[model samples]
Target: MKAKNFLTTGLVLLATFSSVVKAQVAATDPLINQVSHLLIETNKQGLVKAKYASAETRLADLIKAGRSDEARKQMSDLISKIASDLATGQVKADDLKNRSIVTAKKLQKAQLEAVNQYVNGTLSAQDLVNTLKPLNSHYTALVSVLQRYQDVLRSGQSTAAPAQLATIKAGVTDKSSILYARFRLDLLGYSNDTTKDTLTDDLTQAITDFQKNEKLTADGVLGSGSWKVLNQDFAGQISQLRISIDRSRWLPDNLGATHVFVNLARQQLQLYVNSELSMDFKTINGKLERKTPILFDSMTHFILNPTWTVPQNILLEDKVPMFTTNPQKVLDLRMKVIDDLTDKEVDPFSVDWSKVTENNIPYTLVQKPGKGNALGFIKFPLTNPYSIYLHDTDSRNLFAKNDRMLSSGCVRLEKPFEFAEKVTQSMNMMNWSADTLKDATENLSPEAETSTRVKLVKSIPVYLFYLTADVNEKGQVILSNDNYGIDATTYDIISQK
Candidate 1:
């Protein structure tokens, strides 16, 4: 069932790419026919290609052409003026106020074609104006992010940190470095209310707090580990922002009225309600070797007191080896070995250990729900090919650590019970809430130990993406590490296309 859904989504994406490739370069073919082969020579040589250099060259050609000057100028000015409104987004205060439903539908169709303008080749001056006008309307918010950084680059000032100093402890006499460190700490939510750059006691406390929150040593010393994190300047962030904007072109102008949006690159999950952000959570995604694939699926149900059916790879590589190393640990864990063909429990001791291998494992291994169960109390199951689901973890300590890419092809929620409640209420799943889920899983008796899947009133969409940079609540750019090693590759893909 998951496989079918995945295949369908893959087909849709491939179809989108096909349409993007074949889309007409002109809104009206006659407009392009009127301005055919209007090429810009880019007369200036030996000069570094600036941010809007291409647009500027095209503008000059249009001014020379005289006939298409007004049309081309509009396109050039729009690209140049995106930085005017950075914080409020290029969107109006209300979604409906700025949108022309009839125009928006046409713009959506044209925006899909505009991506090919960068990929296929040059466009005549008039056709470029027509193609860009609709795209500017539909993709203004996304385009603004790209243009914001472009404006920064055009101004000849780089936001990337220029240098890093040697290990400077708390009592350092260098005021310059200390002031910079204080700024970094303040940005990280560890504020110190001091005007002195002498590293006061209050500043030291802030440094220690920042270190603790980042899962670093609480020594309050400025060292190599801390410097790496402090150096995320805007110049560096723009590259990923460009990549994110390109990827956003393929997505819907609006994701959904309500949806679960997960950025695997950032290792964060967001829940949107009524097209507005309602809650966000820290998430642990799949590890490097076992990647969490990008999926556009829906959450159909959740399980209470969930039992884990160990997959074949884990059964051979993890469970079998661990149990073989210490047989007594198996009994302590309350693991059950069952026959593969029949729904019958088998005695663990009776199985011949010497015969078990990757090629010939004829039994299923399952862990019962309770303390030390891999899934802590509750699980939110989604339909996907990888059998991936969102659930609580028994190892809650990992949540404090900064690097949270530690799961095996599934997501671990920071507050699973709370998430379960929000999702159930939102989806009308059994008219449930946090308290109801708490009552269902709190029972300690054997009668309530088994897995119970509750159906949803309506399935909720979940989108797993790879956005590496995005705006914050205050509308400032934030960057994330490239956990999946796709930032560069994705950048290249978008640039080529």
Candidate 2:
């Protein structure tokens, strides 16, 4: 497959680190020695080793020539290269999976030592800054998670093929498939009645739980989606890890003391307060065709009983045709058509129905908030080019499904009022409490003409990310469905051989 230049921007940003180390300390300084040791250790582990040799040689030459500035630049460039390679998993080892784990851990340890040395005043601030400029929080988290992933790889268990699983009878399947299923379930810590050859009631419950954890239908039966994730080979799983790691590296090291994180891959939202996991809940993201963009922004405020203005695309594709077919459908849904220039509600029946094509529709459709409203009862507005936000949905049944990618683009929260209360308290919004928000929600009515807007005194950071692989509390690898196929596409681009 042809490779896309998606890494071009990242590489350019990495190159900007060339000037980060401006320290003119002598070549014989202990800080220089520390950097040299780090380089040697990194090379020994074959962590993107080949590309750094020339830079290291140049740095050595500069040091020997008493050119401290040049040496610092060379060192910074080399460190940047190492960081870039770590982020991309461009390992040079013959056995990538096992070798990458070693390299990642070594680099992680070296980074920590540098940080500690700086705190102890053994290393200069300049050197420490340059050393850590590239290794962000994502890099540290990725290294830790990658180490845990090794357990899955080391299990050495093979899953049944899709074709084989498809042919399994109720109680007559071969033991090999059953054993594979049991071993996988056991590995994931959802094991039950392993002594039985068939999928007993306990084992079925385990499967149901596993399916729910993986964000799939909890039918207690192994379906195609379950097999697809279970049957991923070691290399494929590693690719997913690498892809998620690289994607995470794009985010800021400090996400903030209190922030909201939406992992679209898992269809989950987490609220962190003072860097602690405060709460988490199920969220419905955009559909595959209309994917919710991966981005970060400050959630400035939330609207109670918010109105929904149909976007141009949605207007043209869905509403125009519906209104054209049956004009009464507009009032039936409590949507008002306002004239573009007059700023006044236009009667849908007054418009020339036959002439009003999607392109010729000169009015905007705004859905009033309340029962059956698209935006539901609340909307957490975020500043992003995609115009995406966290919102409520009256169709609460959608949350019960494993796959909740059912929106146009914005995120639909299962518990919007609860989320708003937490955000308000976390941000120290004045004159509001959990019970206050609850009362407002309960009192809100379909006939409410205007929404109650509450702007926070300070905005809270929010990140919409897509990470396909994560570790559970037990440190077992939990992989989610790559509904957007981003993992496969990005892995192909970055892992090009």
Candidate 3:
């Protein structure tokens, strides 16, 4: 019966992908018409070179000659090329179907073999479940990704008319941008009705919802930031989805029983315990110019009341200018400049402010460990060449903002103490609880300026990845804001494939 069930499930999963592709292909004539129209519309918007760069000169010449029949034939040929490319994808899907069936049979056969070990009272139930959990997780992730891919393909077939929206705020009445905003918001599932184009209260709320999801400032105004995201047409969205799917495949099949996954695109961190979500933390990542690198490492340790050593870039660009203008800022923050050669603290008041330059900086600026410390109270260091880590921040007000990409390179946690407690419990650090950890710092003297570093018994795996698209808990596909424009860069390379 289990074997039969496995066969049924496999068939259903494959059918879902196969049916969607087949249905789209079945209306080949309409599909061609749709493609032709899309090409023309995109060309008008100077986007012809995106996918049809090779055919651009020829198509242009044909259009110039007013050869309607030949132009249609040329477009038909292009469509055929696209169809041929997609057919290759179908072949790959068919190959996956075969492999899945074989794997399912092998799994069923292996289970039957394991039944004998169970009958002999050798294989325990918990052990069996543990063995199967990774496989189950792998299968679930695969199916979820496949579903998202199919949904994206289907959505592309129903591209809304291209509408360009200009910057506008609330109470803006009867403008083309307003109309476009309404339709675009409605299409994105943030709004329901597009019949009303004016910036009504309903439209304002919808824009606000869209802004929040996109990680933009939720001011409920259709400004440049909002328009930038809403302007991603069907082709651009499809390209993004393709890139996301390819990147998703790069992740390990099993991300361990316990791990930390950071999505740089969403600026969020997820902690999974026993392969189940334990906690979700809002994070403030790096700025657009200073991007947080995508990497994989293990969190080896965390510090309590961590002292912040200002990086060279920060010193040169931010602090030096501030200190040059107003030296009092350094004294207020309890910042000290240490001579790099002598390893001794230098008085900020002794240095000539106007003479200091980035190239001639001879001292390292370090902030003392206290309430005013930049690295707040805790710091989780990861083993990476980028020198980026997850840590607490003194700027708590930044968390309240909808758009929280305000860091230099490191990630700032919203709930650092809670995260520390979870990490402590996970490592089973000898009798250490959140309260005990708090107590360690609670009694610190004002003159004390040392950080306590607790090395983990077992390092927790950490993955810093960028994914612009994700499958939500409810099985719905959602898009994240591409703050770093990494998606566009990645799509350029993957589109060739």
Using TM-score as the measure, which candidate wins?
A: 2
**lDDT (tens digit, per residue) of candidate 2 on 62-105:** 87678877776666665555544543344322223311111132
Model 1 poorest ten-residue lDDT run: 39-48
On TM-score, the stronger of 1 and 2 is 2
Q: With candidate 3 superimposed using the best TM-score fit, by how many Å does residue 112's alpha carbon deviate from the native?
A: 30
- TM-score against truth, every candidate: 0.64, 0.67, 0.60
Off by over 4 Å in 1: 1-143, 158-235, 427-431, 491-497
The whole-model C-alpha lDDT of candidate 1 against the native structure comes to 0.57
Candidate ordering by lDDT (highest first): 2, 3, 1
lDDT of the candidates, in the order given: 0.57, 0.65, 0.61
Clashes of each: 0, 0, 0
Please identify model 2 stretches exceeding 4 Å from their true place.
1-80, 85-139, 148-211, 216-231, 353-361, 428-435, 445-449, 472-476
Cα error, residue 249 of model 3, in Å, equals 2.7
Which digits, one per residue and each the tens of the lDDT, describe model 3 over residues 42-72?
2211121234444534644565566756755
Q: After superposition, how far is residue 418 of candidate 1 from its true place, in Å?
A: 1.0
- TM-score winner, 1 or 3: 1
